[model samples]
Target chain A: MTPQTGRSAGPGVPRGDLPHRAGATGWFDTRHRHLGDWAFVVNRLSGLGLVAYLYLHLVILSQLARGPEAWGGFLAIATSPPVLLFDVLLLAGLLAHAFNGIRVTLLGLGLVASRQKALWVALMGMAVLIALAGASRILGVTS
Target chain B: MATLLQTPRPGADADPAAPARTLRVRRHRRGDSAEGWDRYTAPVGPRTTVLDALTWVRAHLDASLNLRHSCLHASCGTCGMRVNGRDVLACVTRLEDLPPGEVSVEPLRNQPLVSDLVVDIESLYESLDGVRLPLVRTSEGAPGSTPAEGVGHLTRFEDCVECGLCVSACPIVASDPEYAGPAVLGAAWRLVAEPRDRDPEPAYALVDGEQGAWRCHLAFECNEVCPTDALPAEEIARLRGILLRHRVVRWLQRHARPEEVQP
Candidate 1:
């Protein structure tokens, strides 16, 4: 389909004379082209996951409602290698989602117009933090 | 009757200006049939509008031409048609101003097409109808009871012609089928933001469900294409802020209740 043109064209040239190009060029281009949509979708899904984690953590903490035996079992399940790995993954997704959301929020608020590089930097920072904290906990360096 | 004196004729033939170029308009013959372009000659003039050319074609060239237009001016808001693949007011688009070539006219996208160059706008109208575009009045006295001294900001929002260009151009509408879309939200924002709108609580609940303003990711495509300067992005943003604040306030109120408080 031809791109719409207005009286802006010079005489004798048709609007569709120009080559047809898709709105997006490649995978990277689409990611940036539909950045708002992608960001919203990723943020919402990750937020839901984080909310689930919050509820799960609250429930595990509510083991205080039970005796130490129950709390011991819950902690064991949580600290198991697989569960710990999943937790790390969840934390990574959460941080990425949140930092990206904040970046978008800043852009939307006009607090920052040239936010692309800044968004990447913020996301990388979150990844580093998540990796460091998760590795330290898993390697028994700290709780 | 007295006989009048006869004058001699010198001209053997008279020729007027050459006919202007033919404009090929797409005709949607059937509900399921593919659309085809049908050429119709039009008089070229600097000030001639696309709507005028279409009207001339319909009147003299093809009476079977199907299109919806009303109020040759933009105020009536009915003459919105896609000119050259973009949504524009046909009445306001002068032919001479367009590129000197074949201009493709089509029905508005993301909506049902009733016929050539006419899309069903009832869906948008229904969405607007669904919004409770008013604030409840207090029992003591009516809101806006004082003389309607117009505030420029609020009153300008009321100038929405409901042309649906914003809706057509909106990326949200393209992605989410259930979105109330920009036109409806634009109208809703007018009432929601009105200074005299009493009991704004109702406006908060009006858009809670699927594809409401919350679905809008602040693309601002609606704001960019609005024929009138009704910035829908600003309005939707304000609505989001109001709704979030209201929820937070309600949560605080509930938590602060005496029964919920522990000594």
Candidate 2:
């Protein structure tokens, strides 16, 4: 073992010049090279996207104050093919965020901490299944 | 400061034409000094481990290389280090399991680096010690007396082995030094979960601070890197549950007794 004494950098001391910060972007960038880590990043990103969409949704709803013609015109543009595709993407994000949330909650409750990788795979699979079902219904493929 | 050392030896019992594989080790001269990675190539056998490669490098090439290992097996956690950016027991991490080409070895992160591949684990032990955990009996029994009936079915709580790998893998401890990492909180959880512990209240109070269970983000990195299967992330989650229940109960009690509330 290396001699413990005379080590200038002790525990709790910051090594400023080190190549990487302790838990900065390194946590998500370098260290997070596994499936579980990717799940966490995706969860956070999807959550933020959902929040942004919610604000935009509220803004769109407030267009009703401009009268029926304005509101109807906005709805007509919103339901166009491009907007519909964006909505589908939003739905995918919502499903991913919701399913991953359940997985994280179960893990926090210590229900399936050991089988987290399997749980993640199962939840992501379920998310894709639900998203596909919702997409077919929204795009008039199932009707 | 990258030095490549290659050693060639013909095998007596096995095929002699097998090319040797290189082990790349990241080394730091001092705790505060700049770091450099060195490469050492040694003949790989069926049972060669990362620890064996380090041993070979030290024996043949560099005497100044510093590392710690004992038992040459996974029993002793002294050889814990980051192999290929992941925390693992060097004694048990086989070279064959690593990706083809080079295997990188470095000291455990989030701790005081004493020298090459040697981290100061005293702080981890001190954090566990600060909890002042004791097994409190729920029944009217002496300290050394046998347990009463019906209490034997409680699940056994595995104690932290002080390997420091979990702490090294903990991002909370890496960023914030004040936060007591998984190993410490996991030990606290084991004591708090003891069925016979009359007053787990003290254990709860110990971890009630901002740097305690509340700070954990439930990343599960500690659980992923734990060599002993101690499951520190699960323990931290359990501790969070206990602390949450405690806060809710305390809030309810305070609201229930309106007369005791001072104006």
Best-fitting candidate, measured by lDDT? Answer: 2
Candidate 1 scores a C-alpha RMSD against the true structure in Å of: 14.8
lDDT of 2: 0.74
How displaced is residue B158 in candidate 2, in Å?
A: 4.7
Q: Residue-wise lDDT of candidate 2 within B57-153, one digit each (tens)?
A: 7776677788999978677679998888888999999988888978888888888777778887888877777765554345534577777553332
lDDT string, candidate 1, B54-163, tens digits: 88667655776788888888887787877876678888888888888766666666666666677678877777666645533333235555533434455556567777
| TM-score for each of the candidates | 0.59, 0.78
Q: Which residue segments of model 1 deviate by more than 4 Å?
A: A1-103, A107-143, B1-22, B132-150, B195-199, B259-263
Assess the local accuracy of residue B69 in candidate 2 as a C-alpha lDDT between 0 and 100: 93
- lDDT tens per residue, model 2, A1-143: 13333335668766543432266544555353456666777787898899999999999988898899989999899878898789789999999999889877876665676677888899999999999998888787888
lDDT of 1 at A29: 25
How high a TM-score does candidate 2 get?
Answer: 0.78
Error of 1 at A106 (Å): 3.7
What does TM-score give for chain A of every model?
0.61, 0.80
